[model samples]
Target chain A: MKNIKVLGSGCANCKATFARIEKVARAKGVAVTLEKVEDFAQIAAYGVMSTPGVVIDGKVVHAGGIPEQQQIESWL
Target chain B: MFEQFAHFLVYQLGGLSPASQLGTALHFWVMDTTKILVMLVVVIYFMGLFRTWLSPEKVRRVIQGRSKTLARILAVTLGAMTPFCSCSSVPLFIGFVEAGIPLGITFSFLIASPMINEVAVVLLIGLIGWQLTVLYITAGLTVAYVGGIAMERFHPEKWVEAYVWQIQMGEIAQPAIDTSLRGRHVFAVSQVTEIVGRIWLWVLIGISAGALFHGYVPQTWVAGLSERENWLAVPMAVMLGIPLYSNAVGVIPLAEAMLAKGVALGTTLALMMSIAAISLPELLILRKVMRVPGLLLFVAVLMVAITLVGWLFNLLN
Candidate 1:
């Protein structure tokens, strides 16, 4: 199963990425699992320095800021 | 004759109960006001002082390489002294790694940066008494020291990205600001207002949370779980703390609130420090520099050590 992580503090940017990811995922009919990681330690494990990050299946796809929906879709 | 004198004095000074009440109120007011005022002064003074002494490049140079016992100590002590924010945590990592510092010693720097900020320390003293103030500082410094040393022993250098090594080395210049005695005072006041004023909200939040725990959370409940032997509470606190990014500012308000609510001082403080210091956000940020294994080890060591510290304080106090 594809696992997606939207790592953020529920900020607008973080939510936006989640919405975008959800939109992109829904369009593709991907049954990927999504989770929000807010913990500092877990986030460090991913090695990302910025919020509004995206991790697909365990790879950090975006960091510090939100990437475009298309970029996220590519990873999915 | 003495009895008569006592009676006359009591009559002159108003009723004994009223006099006693006045004395108690005065005592509390003096204590509260002084701690707040003096702590503000001291934090301001320290901030300005660092404007002269501390630098990231210097920190890198001091802690780098094999002879690291000294470096770890300096990193924690000095790391606590600096006023950088979570955003700056990344830049500092780049600076330290480039300076040839060991992974563990740099961890010391990272933990201390936010956990023991001056604002948190001073505000702590202001709200709580001096004993806890000293205890927090000592515990933070000790954890950084011991934790860093452990990391170095079982060292993992593979975690860092090769890109950090590619960045050009730049010298850390001394602080740009300087002033006379009067200028220092003015600088101190301005720094107080600037730094403290900015984070007052955070302080309120942290203290409030703490106060809530203090007031509502039963000591037996925390004591049951937070004891050295307890399996659930320590990990839960650390796990809960990991994701949250509560700055010193946000934390202080919660602390105050917890204390007001009768929360166990040690337990709330332990959880609070964990959030502010060993936060998952910081770990995630650090992972960019360190591998997953290294990051996990760091977090594990910190969790155990801080939980132990919390347990010990609870027992002693």
Candidate 2:
């Protein structure tokens, strides 16, 4: 089971990443729930200072950039 | 000898006021000086805590994700939330790729983290009110989003060192550690001290300069010479800011004073952002991580993008 956090201001990159994640998840039949973290305070709690961040389980796995599709699938 | 004498006379004639000038200078100095001292301790405290809870390597190792786009979006959103100052950015940048963060996505995070912060937002809300504050937030976030995508498109692989792209071995083997309340308190004080120590001077300079411009300079000068009329204000301001560094937290107070003197919101913001993001200080720091060409490209793109943002904001208002 994977819990996904797509952290960013609702912008093109944020939306694009969510779309890509969903695409890969659906294709791979992975069990995952995507949560959108928009509040600035909550994002800080995770110690992330960049947008479009990804958190899996309890740890922040990505903060500055987007990872590739295959990588997401593998993580799932 | 003639030029020296002429300059001496100009200084004497520009006399404006003694008490008011000193008072204004003091007022600006105290306000910004306080921020510097506080931020210094805060940043250093965070550093100690950072070291305790997250190893440099462990911190690097943490942010590895699946989808590139999702990661980028998260980075921007996260950037907005955490409100990173310039100081925190360096170590984090070093640790990020070591943790397996991607380049294009990292760019998004880097752009957003410092641009849209809580301190900036609060200051904006208080000084300019909520509407413009929202506008600023929207514009800042959008830049991170679009600018990030643009960077991805151009793919400046040359800018990144070969080693920076690959994951570096971290302190994964270290024993589990926990930081307590007393330790946290000490860390916070130190952070305040460190950040304040360095930036106090900047705060003073920013405010006094702003106050002088506020009280003395003709308000018509800024309003009259706007881009719609002069065209050069935008680029000139941008160029000026690129080589200078100023914090939004510190700059906003000055900006408020400037607006009081008839300076338009757009021009003030443009100059502020330029000083914060593309300034020489930030650029020089970037040089450590990026080659000259890569640095230039980043500066060029960011400068053009922020200027347009400032312009659109003025138009809307």
Candidate 3:
């Protein structure tokens, strides 16, 4: 199972990012523990300034926008 | 030329009469949209390439221990250069503060990030002209500089939410970004796609509104507001703009329309700045990180500064 975190401040983009990650993971049948990090402190701690930053297993894989499906597939 | 193309499409091909209001409005919309979109793609791609070298983390690192004056200058300049989304403002704020960057300098970055950017500059040039675009950029940077200084005098540090100071930032490894030539090209292309995708609707709305205003609104209707004696127009424009949440891209075309209807340059510029800079939604987002007093102070400083800029330009013009 992969531990994935979506960091954002509850903006529309953040919500969309969270949804997309879930959808992609389910489709790929990848076992993942997904969490949404809304706290600014935690987000800043990760050094991700842009919202909807994606962190996979303690590694920030993307920031600033929704990740493309191919990128998500590669991660899975 | 875009004008000739628009003329041909609207009149020659579409078979609309040149003198018709629909024809004129359609022509204006088509010409302006085509020109603005083309300029946006080229400019945003270049800006995206430039931005690979400058990120918020990098900006924080550079400004962390600098002298006050130098830091403020750098903050404003980098703020304009950094392609930041308003959604990220809270984290950006906390990140800067956590890094020991002064509150004033952080405010400078916050002010400039939204108010002056490649999209705003490109749209201003496409809609109005380079002269006003230059003035707008100058005025934006000046406001950011002075506003930072002004906010510092109030000891804004005291007004921040206590929770912000309590949270400890961890040492997370920076993700290695692809910086190869092809990687830069891919980044630039994505930027163009994302930005154009996000703003195309707003652009169309703004241009269509301008087109309608151009086709129907009489010059005499706006003459009273544009008249030299009506000094209230500048301040009023600023106040009216605060609630009308829009980015700079969405406001410039409407500004061009107002200018065409004989509105004073100062009034139009003031409205554009206010709409682009001091938005209610952005303020609400900031409020989560700041106390009411701090939020009020930020808004007050921006309102006063923008109003002053409006008046100054009005007086000069």
Candidate 4:
């Protein structure tokens, strides 16, 4: 199972990103533990200045805006 | 060409007489909506392509240790160019501080990022003209510059959250964006999609409100407010705009309508700047990283600067 974390302060874009990632993972039948990180310090610790950042298994995969469906699929 | 198209669509096709108020308002709405939307897509796409190279990380690195004057200039410029989302302000603020950027410089970025943006610029040029656009940009940058200096005077470093100073930022591998021609095209396309998706409703609402004002609001009432004797207009406009909490995109069309209705330029400009720059939600977010005093000072500085800009423009006009 992949550990996927969405980092944001619960903005609309972040919520949308979380939902999209989950939907894509489920559709791909990929088992993943999804977590939402809303803490600003934690987000900055990863050096991700933009919100709705995606972290896959401790690696920063995306930052700033929602990831595309195809990109999410490739991650899965 | 847009005017002709709107004329054809409203009068020729819809069979609405141009003499009627509803018809005139509908024509204005259609023309402005189409014109502004086209301009937005093109301008935003190009801007996105250019902005793909800029990130907060890079901005932090550049401004980290520059001289005060040089840093302030760069901060405001990059702040205007950077495609920033207010939701990310907290992390961005922490990142800048962790990178050892000055508090004043950070405030400069915060002010310019929202107050002067591509959407506002493009819409201003489309709805109004280049002269006002130039004035708006100049005023925004000046406010940002002066505001930064004033913030630094307070020595606001002490007012930052204690935890923010303690947190050490770690280097993380950033996802590399595709930088080829095709990649830029894709990025720009996505930018257009995302931006238009987010703001289309607001644009429509703005244009509709503008249409109503244009069609129905009497010029004499607007004149009363615009009169030089009415010294309260600018401050009143600034105060009235605080609760609106809108970005520049939604306010420009309404501004255009107000200008057309003979409202004073300064009052309209004040309203636009206040709505774009100060908002309750953004303030609440900033509260996480700044103590109450720092936050209050920040707001006070912005309020005074914006009010001064309003009055200066009013005096000049």
Predicted model with the maximum DockQ:
4
Q: After superposition, how far is residue B298 of candidate 3 from its true place, in Å?
A: 1.1
**Shift in Å, residue B91, candidate 3:** 0.9
lDDT of 4 by residue, B163-239 (tens): 99988878843535677988878888999998989888878887787788878888788787555546688888988
Model 3's C-alpha root-mean-square deviation from the true structure amounts to 2.4
TM-score of 4: 0.93
Report fnat, model 2. 0.00
Ranking by TM-score: 4, 3, 1, 2
DockQ of 4: 0.68
Model 1 CAPRI rating:
incorrect
Indicate the worst ten consecutive residues by lDDT in candidate 4 chain B: B169-178
TM-score of each: 0.63, 0.56, 0.91, 0.93
Per-residue lDDT of B244 in model 3: 95
Docking quality tier of candidate 2?
Answer: incorrect
| Span of ten consecutive residues with least summed lDDT in model 2 chain B | B169-178
* Chain A TM-score relative to the true structure, per candidate: 0.89, 0.89, 0.96, 0.98
Q: State the lDDT at B295 in candidate 2.
A: 71
- Poorly placed runs, candidate 4 (over 4 Å): B11-24, B172-176, B213-225
